[model samples]
Target: MPTTIRYSISDLATYFESTTYDRIMVLCDENTRTHCLPLLTKWIPHFQIIEIASGETHKNWETCMQIWEALVANHFTRNSLLINVGGGVITDMGGFAASVYKRGIKCIQIPTSLLAMVDASIGAKTGIDFQDIKNTLGTFYEAELTIIDPIFLQTLDKRQIISGFAEMLKHGLIADKAYFHQLLDYSFENTIDWPLLIQQSLHIKSSIVAQDPTEKGLRKTLNFGHTIGHAIESYYLEKENALLHGEAILYGMIAALFLSSKKFNYTSAFISALENFTEKHLSTAKIKIDITQVMKYIQQDKKNKGDQFLFVLLDAENQILYDIPCSQNEIIEALNYLHD
Candidate 1:
């Protein structure tokens, strides 16, 4: 049976106290090594540390090969534990490496970013993006445990925080109506109640993954704003520098909202609320979108089926997410709304 784990900052020591392993390897990026590892090392004394170059560009086969070589050279056997200690990129690649290494090994996730804690950490999906395509190469491997510590948010830049929050907002829009309304009441300036938000988002993802771990059915709901969001992210990432994951999703959410209103006849009031929430919280970074480039990227999206592009749009109350298909022209119109 699979074990369900709950992670909290205060419970870090207690969580690791009972764990038994011959050797432990901690994977971290530059930023995390400088800011997070010092604090983490005090608790986990009997562990070897490895640092990889930071950023999305480094997530590739070459990197994976390097990790594999290190494990082999160091004689890291199956009895060893791989502890992924960073954001999405670290967790995704680390989890993938551990899963493939030695056929399989126990891995744990200690996510630092809000995005990782709520979304990436919970899901078994792990992979590296190929070329410009997002998450093109990957696997479904759940970690033995996931440890979430909001205290690490102190080291994150404002942009990183906002990026993670977009996914959290996506959780609310897709499944929980009450959580959606509650988000409307909180501002980014205020400290988020981490425990409550983490539990709610975990519950949302856990329910979906429990029903469909392979993503054949209801797990599609979690892709609410990801369709167009990922395209925009890829397009801008290729054309420009400095666009964060959450920022790209912010624009993706805007395009999705427009699609929801147009196709679903979702009420104008609901639309206004979503737009207001976006403008107030999301930054205005103008991205030059060549309609052709965006269209090309969308064609390669993993969610695309046949000729139509599928999107997860919400109803008026924000309770149910309807999977709707849009033609090429409709997608262009939705992109225009981002410019407006």
Candidate 2:
């Protein structure tokens, strides 16, 4: 399952002009509708536009129903093409909707946000959060193509850019340490060269995904920071001042690093380097976990089996140790360590 990640819009324009579908429809959130869709409209003028509310909060069945209803009303057939033109939430929910609609439909991803462009849009893992759980219902439906235009990043605020940068950092940590060093060169103040950064992140992820598409083994490393990150993201969903996915992920990575040192005996210098780097880049929030409540979410995590919690831990060599069944007590201990 090698995902074709288009780097240049000129190349994408060439492809879009030559390609044709029965019915072309595009799904975008308010933000992307304002900022990014215009670029697509230039090349694809006749595509039907379906606008949805933005944010991770709207990623649910109700919104998905709206998408399905729209597709139904439009008389979309299997040959119809669905283009997702927003960040992670839009692509995730839209891909899920497009996949199940009429059993399946051809879909393409035009990832505007850095998060979507890098990780979410590449994997073809379509999902929507259910009952506050992250990505509860989903399918592995690959997009016919994925177009990544770094031009969209021009409108992004520092926080939005930083949000995506977390995943890139994770990619480096999980696979290539040298890539991690490359990431340290930029920040919210010092801008990044998006084309190169996006390509680097894509290569790391695609190479890993190429080995294991259905997450049977190696793909689990991608879930490194997510196990705890999703819990934090879910817990804060109802709050007014919620952290973005990457912000939450930074915390999860910190906790995971702590756990890695305790569980896998990861090198002390590497753990310290990661902690210092993360703390420097991400703002810390005083999220006082109920510890008990969060464990419930972890227990219900998709990676877990009956009464067992699965973690992807980093070992001394900086390689991932996936499918490590960790004890609840150990997790609690890690949580306590984080709290301290």
Candidate 3:
């Protein structure tokens, strides 16, 4: 049976009330601690709170070790509840710690960022990046529930909002054509209908995640742009000072769309539509990425088996996942197209 889910601001309280657990642990970062934590404290006042430094760089085994130490010190058992209340980094690391601590425990995700609500929170795939590789160590563990409130987005900066919008665009490209069109029509600047967008994007992601929780078959489709997207993300993380996940994924989507047109023979019209939509919302910042570094990261991707790199290319109308063997030259071309 599928797990229960809710997407409302008040649902967190309701969920907290209904659950029977000895103790609850709420995880937050510095930013979320300053911004969203106060708002959440009114409802979850009695719970044990754990604050960690925020950012993708902190999502690692070292942080996980610290969480484990905290759990041990606080006498957190298997029956204890962990509520992840922040962006993807917090949710991902927190979920991972909960899953591994005492051989897995129940967790609730109260995602604050746009990216976390639509993509990271629903999937239950939790992990931290190994060195520069993205999501290197992780597990498939479903959350007991996920509570989403678009109200938290008001505190987010414009770049953060745009970053989250990239994943919503990915959700549309993979599943709903109408939703994709709707996203194109909406303005990212001032006219975003957060509630509707959150519902639609979560619906698309949850349905996909429910169907293939382990990411063994159709769920691989959810990684439509992630193969190159993740590599691009790692490359930027290693080379640059600060690049948000959504921003890298936005560029990844651009590259994937270009690859779809050139290699997969997708229509120019479709490519044009994707380009126009991305250009309107995504920034065209020139990140000087070394093709060799990106290739090394791609080769080390967990999805790759043996020597063959499994690349997910979009078909006409984005109907099916076509797994293709891509070469270094092809990847360079894709990145080059993104630069151009």
Candidate 4:
């Protein structure tokens, strides 16, 4: 069965009251500790805290060791529940640690960031970066539940919110045409109904994730912009506050849309709207990684089979097509198109 996703404090309180869990803990980062932690303290005042360094760079084995060591010191058992609070890094790392700690345990996701609430926190995948690739080490353990309260988004900065919007754009492009149109017209500068939009995005992704929990077929569509997006993320990860995952993805969406137009005869109006949006909001830092470097990372993408690069491309009508083999030269041309 699919895990229940709720958007209320009462639901969270009910879970905390459950006798199924013998112990409870929160895995968070420095930023989440300062900004988002207090929101949970009222409900989970006695819950153990597992704080770790923030950022995609720290989503590694070393950090996993920190979580594992903390649980050990606290004598956490299989009946213990770990609620992952914060964005992608904390949920990914926390889920991984909880799933593998003695084979398996219970995990609940409390997604504070827009990206996590809408996308990352919904999927059952748990992984940490290994070698130079993204999400290279992980498992298929699903979370027991995910709590997404829009109130936590108030703690996020504008950049983080915009970064999260990128995935929403991808969600629209891949699933709902009306939603794609809605996103095209949606403005990030002003306030809107976040709870509504969050539900919309989560439904699209969750439906896909449920069908292909193992990512064998339909689930691969969720990786729409990630093929190149993840490579760009890897290339620039070392830089200070460098491209957050969604920024690189917005850049990749630019390239993917370009390829979609060229290869699939995608409508000019839709493509142009996306292009104009990119021109207005995104900057060249979005693709500061040299073409060669991005390509090198793409070659290492886990989705690629053997020597060929497999891309999930969209049709002119915005329908998704997976595992389409893309050539290096064609990819370079797409980069040139994105640059232009």
The local distance difference test score of model 1 is 0.80
In the range 295-323, model 3's lDDT, one tens digit per residue, is 78888888787887676667776775746
lDDT of 4 by residue, 220-279 (tens): 888888888888788888667578988889878778877777789876776677667666
Q: Tens digit of lDDT per residue, candidate 2, span 1-340?
A: 5556677666657776778778989999999999988776777747898999999999999999999999989999987988899999998998899889989888878888899888999877999998888899999989878888899899887788888988998998898888887786565576568888888899999888888999999999999888888887787787788879987887787778878888878877766665666667664433567788778888889999788888989887777898888898988887775553
Clashes of 2: 0
**Measured by C-alpha RMSD in angstroms, how accurate is candidate 2?**
1.6
lDDT (Cα atoms) of all candidates against the true structure = 0.80, 0.84, 0.80, 0.84
Clashes of each: 1, 0, 0, 0
TM-score per candidate, chains pooled: 0.93, 0.95, 0.94, 0.95
Off by over 4 Å in 3: none
The C-alpha stretches of model 1 lying farther than 4 A from their native spots are 1-3, 9-17, 316-319
Candidate 1 lDDT, 255-333, residue by residue in tens: 8878878877766665577667666666453356777888899899888788878888876655556457888998989
Candidate 1 similarity to native, TM-score: 0.93
* Stretches of model 2 off by over 4 angstroms after superposition: none
